[model samples]
Target: MSKSNDAISQLTEKLPILLIEDDITIRRFVEINLKRSGFQVMAADSGETGLSLMENRRPALVVLDVMLPGIDGYQVCSQIRDRFPEVAVLMLTALSQDLDKVMGFEFGADDYLVKPFNPLELVARIRAILRRFNKDSGSLLCSGSFRCDLRAQQLFMDEREIELTPQEFRLIKVFLEHRGQALSRDDLLNLAWGEDFVGDPKTVDVHVRRLREKIGNAPSTGRIETVWGSGYRWREGS
Candidate 1:
């Protein structure tokens, strides 16, 4: 490989992967496999240590197990999103229900992996999540006057940064990904909140109300229209 290519490969392989799984056997197995694959692995048996490692080591991706002793994966995931917005999260859990999965996504996990998962598949999902974020570094998502810098994970309207909560950012991300298309509340929930959210559709309404307020009266973004009987749509043009 060329020098530049070799450097890139090393960086990719060395990209930190923190595994916060309580099961000793499972943690060891995963850590070994990840090490074999050339990833820098940090295995934490509890959520507290994992969070500590996150603060200290600053891993690029976190492989979090949902059912921790005290804090649990959901809370850990929430803290991760709140503290390290750029770090990608992949949840590993024995809870395979759709609601469980939705809850995982609601906590801001980039991907979910059920227990008894193939080691290869787990690694592949991690790679996919990392690539998804990596590929967007310099790209932009725009609708009217609102523009999102994918690399920077920041939104701007008329050249000013639009402060957004993690949930709002994820919601806007869904809208930008499916720009010009109307998304039902369920669709929005699934796309933005993940499939495990088994709550009232009204929840979507509540968030949308808040989101519209945050986005404000900008012309391009003004096209964020309610479809009356349906859900919502972000119209792109005149």
Candidate 2:
């Protein structure tokens, strides 16, 4: 793995992110910001490369650009949604056309961003999406032989208390709250970091690893399954 990949793997163990933009300058700029915010970022300069990386890296979230040489952002987003339904996509476009936005959403974009946007605001939006959509509001969650106390922001395994960092606690809470559902890195990012968050998805992965360690779960035990071409999920009866 390259240094970037190593960094991403480490962070995905906490946070994992993918950025697909044809513009080199913008890609580098966003990658820098995301890395600084404690995320692992994977970058591809074209829609084709982006899609290929998505298949191999399985990033939690994807930042896709609308215009590209081969596959446009809309087409790419649609492909991801169809093949990797769990992955969360955020479409970036220069056009402000309402129809364009609608098209992005229709193609399964979780969020949309116009050019010349504030990086900070983008980060915030990412966090919001993760919080709202990553979590399953319909079901209660249990993990590590313990149940989560959402009201108290605590985890209990085997009747013993396990302390969790605020981020870890929140991540686990989301998983438990949405038990049995797969949450993409973007989903976690939107929930934990916010929609406008410029951070990388690797940050979410790292946090997840820590969460698993704290909960006494193995990474490959199916407690938290990695959905190839998508993100992660907290499986029931793992």
The C-alpha lDDT values of all candidates are 0.77, 0.70
Per-model clash counts, in order, read 1, 49
Error of model 1, residue 76, in angstroms? 0.4
Worst 10 residues of 1 by lDDT: 128-137
Report the lDDT tens digits of candidate 1 across residue range 69-177. 9899999998997788778888898986777877776666767788898998777666655544444446888877788887777888878887654456667888887
**For model 2, how does the per-residue alpha-carbon lDDT over 11-40 read when each residue is reduced to its tens digit?**
443557789988889888888887776667
TM-scores of the models, in the order given: 0.72, 0.54
Model 2 ranges off by over 4 Å: 1-13, 136-238
Off by over 4 Å in 1: 1-11, 136-139, 158-178, 181-233
lDDT of 1: 0.77
Which candidate has the highest TM-score of all?
Answer: 1
